[model samples]
Target: MIQNPFARFLTGFVVAAAAAVLPVAAQQAASKPDFHQWAATPPMGWNSWDCYGPTVTEAEVKANADYMARNLKSSGWEYVVVDIRWYVGNDTAHGYNEKDPAWNIDAYGRFVPAPNRFPSAAGGQGFKPLADYLHVRGLKFGIHIMRGVPVVAVQRRLPILGSKATAADIYSKEGQAGWLRDMYTVVAGRPGAQEYYNSLFQLYASWGVDFVKVDDLSSPYHKPEVEMIRRAIDRSGRRIVLSTSPGETPVAEARHVAAHANMWRTVGDFWDSWEQLKEHFEVCNRWAPYIGVGAFPDADMLPLGRLGIRAERGDDRMTRFTRDEQYTLMSLWSIFRSPLMFGGDLPSNDAFTLSLLTNKDVLAVNQRSTHNRQLFREHNLIAWTADDPATGDKFLALFNAQDQELAPASEAAWASSIITRQTPGQSQPVDVDISGATTLYLNVRDGGDDIAWDHADWLRPTLSNGTQTVPLSTLPWKTATAGWGQVTAGKSVSGADLQVGGQRSDDGIGTHSNSMITYALPAGFTRFRATAGLDAAGAAQNTGGTLQFLVFTQNPFRPMPADSVRIPVTLAQLGLRGPCTVRDLWTGQTTSGVAGEFAPYVRRHGARLYRISTARK
Candidate 1:
């Protein structure tokens, strides 16, 4: 059962502060001041997770920090973050050390950096020496933490710094992170819960830390703890930027997060894969409107340059994205203005990767653009736009979410061309013109009908070119996306017989509502013939199953975009229909006197970014 996030803060659990140990320095720090002002813009930085994983040493961090301070510092990249597992003395790569985990903490029930890994943290000095190291070099330091008090701290019944209660008094087993077993949730409104958090940040404040990324708090969206952390940071009397992570952070909590964090992740840990990057086009768009003055929607780290040397996910190597795909990643992230956190090892950057990072023109959009949003997505073609308030110009990003070599990565690709609704036991013949079509898409939409129990299938689907006929089942679908379960090639979504109308067949794609199956057309195929209906499993009852069938001559965002059209991006679409000159950001070329449409040429799985300076009409 889902626990109410606010229940821990209930009236009965409320514990009034005894005003014990509120530091004198904290009293003057003005914790309640507008935190949004501390981070007027999204924080740009380098992080250690992608390259070093849990095993990054002090030497490696300083190397990357040195590289950034000398190279990317002038470009507004400042924060140097130490990601997860910093307190584990013997942390390993590819994930956390679950069983027999080694830990390091000070007597005050607060975690300190592992001295074995981060040598400067030795002698109980904590991160002050390292933080000072970066500070002197004109860089800010940040660290990642799991939400709540350390389990070891609770096990020891360590004293809470500002209150009489011990860690054991405030912690409950409720809502713990499933993946890691290092921490326990601090029950809100209980004695010492808030004080323990305040004391934790007070130590960080003493170390001069500028940023803190709290993980496991956002995915399940630990609301009470987030509020507690916010209060704790304020009470610590330091201006620290707060970020939340490991997302698809429920969009339902947008307002709550925007009010609390400097940035919150929109998707799960993004990697150097086309599929992961493609998923962001939709996720970023959905969270764009919630971006506020202090809070930005993060698209996770840029997985470029040398990675996985000792990281959690992959083996050590340069990023796997193509040059075109790399361009698309940067363009989309910039246009959306998601807080730019470079995740790869910086010192190992090759020429192309360096070019991607140091490109001033692109970085400007992320730093300065306003009113950004996805303009529209037609077929596999997508566009996002943002405005430059200072210059009154427009920043446009046109994305081709198609990849010919790889399957389209969209979860549910949508387009409406030919549409029909099927009743519970309805059977229908499908015939569609396939003349000169590069690809054909068969879709089952949840629109205009109930979504539950929407079992569907194509039976004996065939293609003919007036002379030769080919069995549709003879070739596999180029790309398949499902809504409920996996799309079965010659069986039902459940991998059973493709039973439609009480008849079982084995020669077509079986899927559910809100599904799409894409097939690359044969060289001379002119017609597609098939029989479609609700699968016998869902149609058996005939009470709540209703689905819409639609076909498209174009791709519904198949990674292969050979048939995808270059959508005409008209000035009228951007609400600036007059004359303007558009400059291509990547090529440094300008097109003058552009009037109606300003369609920039974008490649498959790539993007085209433009800066449009409108002329007065």
Candidate 2:
């Protein structure tokens, strides 16, 4: 799960605090003045989870913090977050508060920092030293926490805030009464419940904390807790910016989450994958409207460049995304107003990767552009419009996620096309003219879509690892076909083509002996198509008995173009006794009927000629 680092810490703190004694003043401080005005704008910066996972150390965090201030601060990337457990060392035999199997905060769980790890903090201080050090450096500090009161609080028979209450008195025995059970449940509006929250934040506020992320408290499931946590933060009198996590924050609950949090995860964990990135495009579109001046629908962290672990038993090192796909991921996220949180290792960042994260123009969209929602999604393409009110100029992003690659990444490729209305009603054509900015900017490296400026015709291609920025006019779209093939082959690929009314052909499209004839299919598809085709040695490949059929959609979304769905049919199924008919799925009409189309293997690769036509009545 992609968690807000600060919230993850708070989860542990909440668990531990139930057992620790709190002074009476702490309870009063919990209901004090508001704490949000401190974070006038959304917080920015890098976190350690995408790189370190449960084993991150103090030295590494400090290094990342140092790097952010020295390099990324000018780009508006500020917060330096240490994610997950820091209460216990890698060894569990130690006094770590291990809990339910699902949320253990030890190794294989969230790790707590061993006293040996950070000698500066021993007496339940947690990240106070780190937080104070960051403050001295003119930077904000933050940590993560899970939701729900801790089970430990219940075990100790701890004193509840009001009327000398005990833990058993507050916990809801009926699971249905609350959403979470891994942690002790708190009854909202109870005499001591508010005091519990107040006391939690009071300790945090005194610990030099500037940011608090409260997790598992989003959505209708935890509305009451969300409100209580927000109140607690405000009352603590430490203007901390609240962030919520793990997404699924429904539209109806947007107003509530937005009111309390500086940011909330809009989707689940966003890994570095073309498929995941593509999925996020649709999800981000849905949550964009909730993003505003002080609050953002966090798209999660940028798992770019380098990730995983090292040493004895580590994770795989290969990048989850291609250079081009990474560009698309960043561009879409930036244009959508998602908070920019780098999840990769800053200590070992490559030059190319750093460039992508630190690009001035791209960062501007994420940090400065006016928030905007998606305008439309069709033909597998998604487009959005954001107007810079200060300059009265609109910034539009047209994305083509179609799976098409022309050639290898040699140079930046450019495609000039019309952005016309789907339905013919406008007097002016949506011809993108990037002819005006003093310095034309394009994030060529972030690949799913190409960025063009209206005033400046020059579009630069940036490599994903952030390596090179080549002019688009100089690159070839030929390598683009590769991306299409990959997309159709992704995990989400349904059947590429299906032979309706059953029969196969031997005719194939765009297939030479040199190119492999492969097809994508849905999970339960049981049909195909075949056409006449010759083999490598000029020998005919005949459809004898039962050839397989396939079906799938076009891989990448091309910007505002006709959507293509691939269908394959087998000659045996078509029963090609007469003309074999191809039908449309939406209209249920035969597309084409041909006689004596007796063939073996017919594969129409990237079908561009077939139109969505109706059959004769």
Candidate 3:
């Protein structure tokens, strides 16, 4: 309801008047595309790729646009992008079809929306109607494109708009994308190369395109075509925000990439997997310093809510990430100043997904916070900090990368698991001291992604008190619970021989993730040991079943603190002083005190974002 469109209109009028009176060079200089102004904050919106893949229908796009306007537009989520292969009318599920693909293009070597797929383009209208449809609702339209001329265009040697040369004059057969045959590389500085790019952007500007994601141009650091696209956007005289795509984009080219595009991907095709989420913790930190130079490091789409309804990866279902992991994804991306393009089908979004997208205070950090960086990454506990530009308060984010409910939430765990998702399905050594403990709890839980088919095993289990040793399975377990089938003693969850990595074990226990088994230990038991791994039966499914292990002296099934993962640190540890007020934005709690050590807790895979400001007496 705010006057954002009005402000933009007013700014345009002022700029136009100023340009009229200025010299040509000055006006041109002022008109150059400085992308920072286009997306002052990280861009947020929805993309079709995750939910509908290359086959997103116009009706579906409209439904999502309607949802965003009705629910999320006021939060500054405006750009609705059609991701990848919109021109391929015959595209099928799980993958793009290269055989006799129904391609759509104009006479001038430019790809257009397929008329059969995009019904509005039945009479050469091509996305203009769809773009206009969004514009009227106070939303912006965007589209995805590969960074070269269509192969059919190059084969036919189609004419280049606004230039004497044709598509063949500017293309190369080398260095083409392995996955798709849609495009051939357009050589840098070749005749009509710039013109071909210029014509594309000019056509897009005419269609009211406000953003474009140019793919396959960043991972190998295709500097030439990237610069040409940057020039083309600037030359079009429209403020279309340029974003580069599909990265693990060489961190070496960080400087040049930031200067040219509004946002570049830091990692590639992030799905709702704990492995991907675990890796991004390191990737985000490395790219933090390069965030604010007129651009951002895109952490790719939020693979939250419902997904894979006729898409590339999974069957139609809700996101694979656990609820707490969903929070972790949002917290990391926001605090790192990465663009958030929600990848779910919007109309299908449940209330929880809607809540994730609409939190104002969290979105503010992505938009306006400064000096964002990793505070620490000690063991599996990681923290990130950023500064509020307006209030000069510090924003702190604490995360527990451990899959199980580890501490500072419970400082008394017999063993706290860490770094298991790194090389999943492999056995990890577990050794914990249990001297004087009457009972021992063995636990396994999902690593914040999903619990489907996560098989856990305790191989070669033993208890040792120096000279004497005992097989853990020999001891009668007091209680056993598994997320799936019955927990088994000295066998697989299905009561088969204890096996992992195709090897059998004579002594162990097997269970599924989100499971726990407890045992009453005899007096003088000094230590417990096991080699833990995913049973081969579960690993063979390749369902990305990740699990974490834990050893606790007390019963872990009891209710933990509502805020479960609290880490204690002094004000000095956060570089602060006396009389500081800390606010948990997610919890909506304000703690006012002359603080020493700050102990903030969140449940498993949950994050606590603290806003610290000086308190007045």
**Evaluated with lDDT, which candidate comes out highest?**
3
- Angstrom error at residue 285, model 1: 1.5
Report the lDDT tens digits of candidate 1 across residue range 397-508.
Answer: 9998864432222322222332233443465777888788888888776534322456678889999988888998888787887655568878887556897766778688
Off by over 4 Å in 3: 1-28, 404-564
Compared with the true structure, all predictions reach lDDT values of 0.79, 0.49, 0.80
Clashes of 2: 108
TM-score for candidate 3, residues paired by index? 0.72
The parts of candidate 1 lying over 4 Å away from their true place are: 1-31, 403-560, 563-565
Lowest-sum lDDT 10-residue window in model 3 = 1-10
- In the range 53-160, model 3's lDDT, one tens digit per residue, is 889989999999999999999998999999899988899877678888988889998888988778997788889999999999999999999989999998898999
Point out the higher-scoring one by lDDT: 2 or 3.
Answer: 3
- Per model, state how many residue pairs clash: 4, 108, 0
- The best-first sequence of candidates by lDDT reads 3, 1, 2
Each prediction's RMSD over C-alphas, in Å, is 11.3, 22.9, 10.2
- TM-score against native, each model: 0.72, 0.57, 0.72
Q: Determine the backbone clash count of candidate 1.
A: 4
Error (Å) of candidate 2 at residue 582 is: 44
